[model samples]
Target: MNEQKPIKVILVLGLFSFLSALSGSSTSLAIPKIALSLEISSGLATWVLQSGLITTTIFLVAFGHMGDLLSKNFIFFSGGIAFTIGSAITGIAPTFSLIIIGRIIQAFGSSMIMANSMGIVSDYFPDKKRAQALSYISMFISAGSISGPAAGGFIMSVSSWRWIYLINVPLMIAVLIFGHHALPIPKVSIKQLKSATQGANWMGQGLFTAGIIIFFLSGAIFQSRSNWLIGLITLVVGGALTIYSFYQDDVANLPWISPKILHNRPYLVSIMALLLVMLVNSVSNILLPFYFQSYGLMTPFQSGLLIMLQSLVMLVLSPFAGYLADRVNRQLMTIIGLVILTVSQIGYLLYPAGMNLTRIIIPIVINGIGMAFFLSPNNALTMGLVDKSLTGIAGSLNSFSRTIGMTIGISFGSSILFALLPNVDQITPALGETFLSAFRGVFYVAIAISSLASIMVFVRYLRAKKTA
Candidate 1:
């Protein structure tokens, strides 16, 4: 611990965190292009998205387990290598099948990185410094996600979408080489390792992984509303598996994630708030570009340019929010954030059809500020609430909440969307008013969801007050 500084570890982890986000978001913009180039169907290209998320969600806890039982940086380093190799493979792959394989590998690597990020950060930084450092991770991730479309667009303009995947390799290699020596490793005893390994609920883990993937596949990619029988059957099966896995883990002599985490009121509430917010947030992410295009306010690329405003706001405010979090009530900031988010949703709801840029930027900027304030403080508070030994599992589950929120958010949002505008194919000019009505309808749902999140945060806040 003495040999190297905590900042180095944070810097390296932060960079990798940035890269992982970049890899996912950047690739998203390339999906249609990739499908076109490979001469594959859109349905097949959907798998390109699903594969990475499925693999990431599946391996999160397992890799989190490794973070604790093995080494945090070791997991981090290995993940970086896996991501780089996967990126290289995808960059050059001649076949769609090969690209899917590469995506899985890349996403698996992302799981490893995400599952351990908080654990590594926790290991290095003390309480006073931890929140601020955690803020750094959020900033980088925001920067990467916001920049992704632009990066992909630019790459495709000059070279190819393949270059976007390849972009990850060089930076990753440098991080790996430098971090090979610089990152700190928490010392683990032989006894500790043996105990954690023995206590692992392998059966529960298997069921959980399989259940989530199948469930996600059923509910999100192919829903019962669309595919009726197939979706319904798989959803039921997956739900059952997931429930049984938890039940099994509950009675097991040893649970992979500490049962205490579930029982922790502050942690659970805070984590739920984070998840709920992300859930609504993802709606905006998916809907906005298309909405802008429909309104003739901007092209998809131009809307992306406007959205850079939100990301810029997040990147700017997060550190400042974190600094305030350490000084004041974290939950207060959280509540403020959620409130602002609801306002933003209202902004979207009241968004006039064919509105000017001023109208557009207001809601976008508000949403960004809300997100920046909420995420880091909530993370710092959640991590703070957990025991040191459970940080790996806690962190992974934390990451899981964000991942799952993002994963299902689009589904939740789009389901309502399609329900509202079932007959409408595209938001054409003739149907623009109808589509705008439906769009406002979706934001109404977003507002309701945002309210639910706000209540959760309030509950958590009240509990903290009572305790204090």
Candidate 2:
């Protein structure tokens, strides 16, 4: 590949990656407005957010396999078109139903992108430069996420929520045209493509998709105390379907959910580690805005700004982290980063109700540094340890794990916080201590979960090092 080709390739990938993050983050700020505009229940508005995540995640494995066996670039391009079209539909839709249809289409396209982007990068960059290149994805995603809310708010102030969805059309069109020339088109035999298509375990995929949706739906249901019984039943049924899906897959040829992935210890550990950290991080993200506004006496903008601090640090540090990931022992780097993250979590756990602004900033800074260090190297480990053919699947699974983590975190964090308060509508001055109790409970659970993840990595590899 020519030097310019690598640069062009990153530009194409980065644009789409940024677009995906922007859609997610920007839409969050617009959800209330959408609900108000449509005169819909908050419940229905939430579906707008959720449909995308569920669709994107469930489709990842299937699309990932396709990217590996058929063509990553093709799948990636098709996804872009789908996303753009979905954007147009949502932008113009008169009814909420149409908006949801648009979201589902967008999710379909997003799954395609998530499944293949890492595989494309792995193909384009040499091993020495791969992690650094991957870090650029992290940076673009962070930029999109941080800018999304601010941008969305600005658009809504002057224009309307529809503009947020509409804006991507021109940008995505530009990326599609650029990517046509930039993304490498790999050559695969017709025989390989045929096998990939014919050998796909359709039954297994359907069951898996059903199970994932039901399970996630159950979690969403649990947000309501009145629906706990239904949620429990749904959760049980979903778990059974997911387990059975895997059980059936064990005997299937060329299974979408491969047994090979489960057997790879390093890859398995890296995935687990990634999931755990995301779960931990997401809890803070979901719970903190409430804390900042309610207990910290901060305005909405101030709350957002405080949270943005972590993303800012991550944006700056990710590239450097990626650079070091290429040169260092990645496992060791992840472990150290986890250690720093543990320290930050501890800081949060111990901090009093007052949450002295200066002291809290220290932990937030540490969390950012820790995440930057852990994420890039760990991302490298996941795709790097797998074979070239499995790279796409590995990347999809990685994205899958992160999405699952975030989803569960939101569910669990909200459930735990509200469960303690029972009927409390607002965090009043009279109930400060009770709110603090629920708040600290989340961090306690988070720290415990993260420690288990750390030990999983540290002990498994410690044993390996000794044996070697």
On lDDT, the leading prediction is 2
Instruction: Give one digit per residue, the lDDT tens place, for model 2 in 296-344.
Output: 7788788898889899999999999999999987888889888888888
Q: Candidate 2's error at 438, in angstroms?
A: 0.8
lDDT (Cα, 0-100) at 1 in candidate 1: 61
Q: Write the per-residue lDDT of candidate 1 for residues 1-468, one digit (tens) a residue.
A: 664577677778888888888878887788889889988887678788889988898888778877877887777778899999999998988998898899999988999899989988887787677788899899889888887877778889999889998888898999888887786445667786676678578899889988987888775644326665787788789879976986788777877667888778789888778778988999998778767776564777787788788889999998998898888888898899999999999998877777577998999999999998888888888889988888888899899888888877766677667668876656666776788888888998889989999988888788778988
Worst 10 residues of 2 by lDDT: 184-193
Clashing pairs in 1: none
